[model samples]
Target chain A: MDDTTARHTEKMRRIKAARDEMMKTKTEEKGLIIVNTGKGKGKSSAGFGMIMRCIAHQMPCAVVQFIKGARATGEATFLRERFVDECRLFVTGEGFTWETQDRDRDIAAAQNGWEIAKAQILDPDIQFVLLDEINIALRNDYLDIDEVVDFLLTQKPHMTHVCLTGRNAKPELIEAADLVTEMTLLKHPFRDGVKAQKGVEF
Target chain B: MDDTTARHTEKMRRIKAARDEMMKTKTEEKGLIIVNTGKGKGKSSAGFGMIMRCIAHQMPCAVVQFIKGARATGEATFLRERFVDECRLFVTGEGFTWETQDRDRDIAAAQNGWEIAKAQILDPDIQFVLLDEINIALRNDYLDIDEVVDFLLTQKPHMTHVCLTGRNAKPELIEAADLVTEMTLLKHPFRDGVKAQKGVEF
Candidate 1:
């Protein structure tokens, strides 16, 4: 074999060996509680993406929107129309906290949303549950972090995955989660005076 | 009006006024150069989500895979099968960097991949272009950062959005980008001894 082919072969062999070694210990499979939080865009977008991933796998999925539920979003509209059979979406929030301006009302709405999410979390048929913007509810003290954690710990079905998305995730929830991603702000067009557009931001 | 109804009405009026004021300033529409980078997962997955968003809008899209192209991924397989008319997926990498090992070959592959990407970026018919893992090629010095930035700045179609996904995005690229999200590592299942599963990781 030529020098290049021989080098590539040797390198791939090393990679395979290392990957095999890593795989040897990676045997556990269980439900994953994934949290997407931080002060940046795409947290909810990523969570929505996971719902699509679930659909691609032919898994039944449910989306429970906590904030930004007063009006329909492009994602909710599209998913409902396109993947009607495989997905169930619940928009339970009255509106954004700032819009509601009533703590008791927000808390009540959050409690109602959590009830929907809890039912999905416990459902064996639903393999992926997206609690979109639920972090904002948790941040606003609309839902008790301890209560949410206890429910997640106790209610999630085996092999089911739950994704929570929003900014300022609670420390307790972060600690309890199996996977967490902090979408850090780098640069945004809003800083440049750009508006949120359909098919992009929503 | 009842006390709670009157309060909610006042709050919603205030919100509508603020929203209208914000909407007044958001008028410009142009293609965005989006960057998803940093040491975290979901960058490429998020990009793929954008591709889906484009597809939902009935817009043509293309994905140019830079690194993880040695094998067929679930995203590629599903998209190719389902959205055959609306999406174009190009897997142009020989393999991951460690698996390839040869600097010269990697550079050549990156150069070739960039050529494909350049064509897609300039295509007016393609509304969304996802450069999957292109940042790794840039980080490895396989493609000249300045050249890539200049091309992105100069040759991009007026209405085509480009999303670059990977870790270690160059400062020059970030400066030129319209939107940037850094996916910070919070917690990962791989660290807890879980293998990359078929539908989830790919």
Candidate 2:
């Protein structure tokens, strides 16, 4: 080997050793409370992608969409058509809060979706559950924050991984979560008057 | 209808009218440059999810992994097994930079990956291209950011969407991108002594 290659090999050896040492301390494993939130795109998309990974692993998944109304997305269609046995999907929202304009109706829809979500979360048979846009309900006071957090922290199944996605995730939820990622918007073409594309956006 | 229902209906009608007016101004359709960056999880996961979206839309996709090495991921396995006809994945990364530890080898691998990426990006038949972990390559100076940005802006087809995902994305790429999202880490279980789970973390 050349001088550069020899130097690199030696450097890599040191890093690998250090990494291995740190990795040894990580031994705990349990179901995770994951949240995807913020004022950016791909929060829901990322959640759906993990569902695909779960499918690859032959894990059962249930998806509960709380705030987006009766709109079909590409991933939803694919999941419905191909992975019926693996995925259970529920779309339970009247519409966006601005479009719906009825607080009681919004609360009713959120509660209904939460009931289904809770069932899925408590089920040991299902390995993954995605609560898409349930945060909007919590943020709007349509769903009780304490009840949700209590169930997630204390009552949920031991092996059932759950993902909550939406903007404005509550501080309590973030604190309870094992993983929380906020998708921050840097720039969006919609601000430039570009229409949302079918596969890319919806 | 009751008084509350009537009022809610009227409010929704007015909001719908306003939304219809704004949506009329958005008529442009073109390929998008999307960037997912920052110090959080799911940037790569979101990109992979869009690839599933593309598959559902019956669009062709190409994915070039820039820094993940030969590691076998669940999504990559699913894509290869199920959507082989619709998706083409090239795992070109030698490994992570620190793991590789050779600047010249890193540059060579990145250049090789870019050549493959450029072919996939320039191809009109491929509707979506995902350059996974490419921002790492760009940030490390393994590839020319200007040349990459110029190609994406000027040479890409009109209807092909490209997603570049990793941390520390350059300013030029973000400015040139149609959509940019930074995955900010609110909390991570790994830091709290949880090992990376197989299907979830991989």
Candidate 3:
């Protein structure tokens, strides 16, 4: 074989090898977890992307936003109305923890959300779970980080993927996560005294 | 009557209103396609629980399985491997087109294998495209269907999801797919006598 032909043959060999690996990798379920943190926008947005991917593939998923509390955002409104039956889209909200003032009540609400989340995470029907703003809740003691990590690890071998988002992710949580992505904040409209943009921030 | 209780009540109302409309409709992008038909099981198993739910969350999803891919099995393996990436998986493969066959190729070969499959359906980054069984080489006029579909569609929105798998799916081409799933039948070990398992065959 000449140069091009030789290259083509070599490429084919590599391709077959890779295909074999892929087949092997795909045979068993691989669980995943992504922690989206740091002070920035779009953590939840990233989670939303995963949700959409799962729906397109016909996988069942669930989403629970702790601090968000159903804020009438365009995304929540759209998904709740149309795709709920097809996918598991749930928004259990108690509003922002700091704003609520009743620390005990806030903790209780977080616990409640955690319970719901716990059930879904373990449910075999649920392939991916987006815990929107979960990091913040864990930081504030609204939810226990240790418990969350424990559940994640226990569920890991089952092929369940989880995405945890929000600011102030604890060091332990970051270490425990399979993929920890910190969305650094270089600048923001909020810092410029501009209010959160509609369709951008809840 | 105190100020604290009054503020809490107001916040509660706001949260409720936001969530009530969670049932409202939202915008959607172009639909996607998922093909999970094949002699092997787990085609739908792979697609249904991962990428499908992602779209269900308003990511814009459309799934078309050429064969009856949605017979739910108590043991679902394909859908569980999606915790790491959601918007990246799209499934489209029909185990085999029963209607097409010829003596030249008993099983899908290079014409349909790595060659046409690569030329046709393998664009890992494309938003959505699933070629389930372009593997039926000479049987289904290998290379033709794969090339045509690859040439036709536009890959965009960056978050499109697709899935494909099945027996005789061209190897070379299927390799190019962002994600590929193959159901290797193990110990259906049913001796020529036993009936097929229910919830196992869809």
- Supply the TM-score of chain A against the true chain A for every candidate structure: 0.93, 0.95, 0.82
Best by DockQ: 2
Which residue ranges in model 3 land beyond 4 Å of their true spot? Answer: A1-28, A155-157, B1-202
C-alpha lDDT values of all predictions: 0.84, 0.89, 0.51
| TM-score per candidate, chains pooled | 0.89, 0.94, 0.47
Displacement of residue A165 (Cα, Å) in model 1 is 0.6
Per-candidate RMSD vs. true structure?
3.1, 2.1, 13.5
Q: What is the docking quality class of candidate 3?
A: incorrect
lDDT of 1 by residue, A48-118 (tens): 77776677777888999998887667777778778888899899998787676666788899999999999
Regions of model 2 farther than 4 Å from truth? A1-11, B1-15
For TM-score, candidate 2 versus 3, the one ahead is: 2
Better of 2 and 3 by DockQ: 2
Clashing pairs in 2: none
B1-202 per-residue lDDT for model 2 (tens digits)? 7897788778878888898888888889889999999998889989988987888888889999999875777787888788889999898998886776777889999999999999999887899999999999999899999999999988999898999999999999998999999999989988889888755777
Ranking by lDDT: 2, 1, 3
Candidate 1 has an lDDT of 0.84
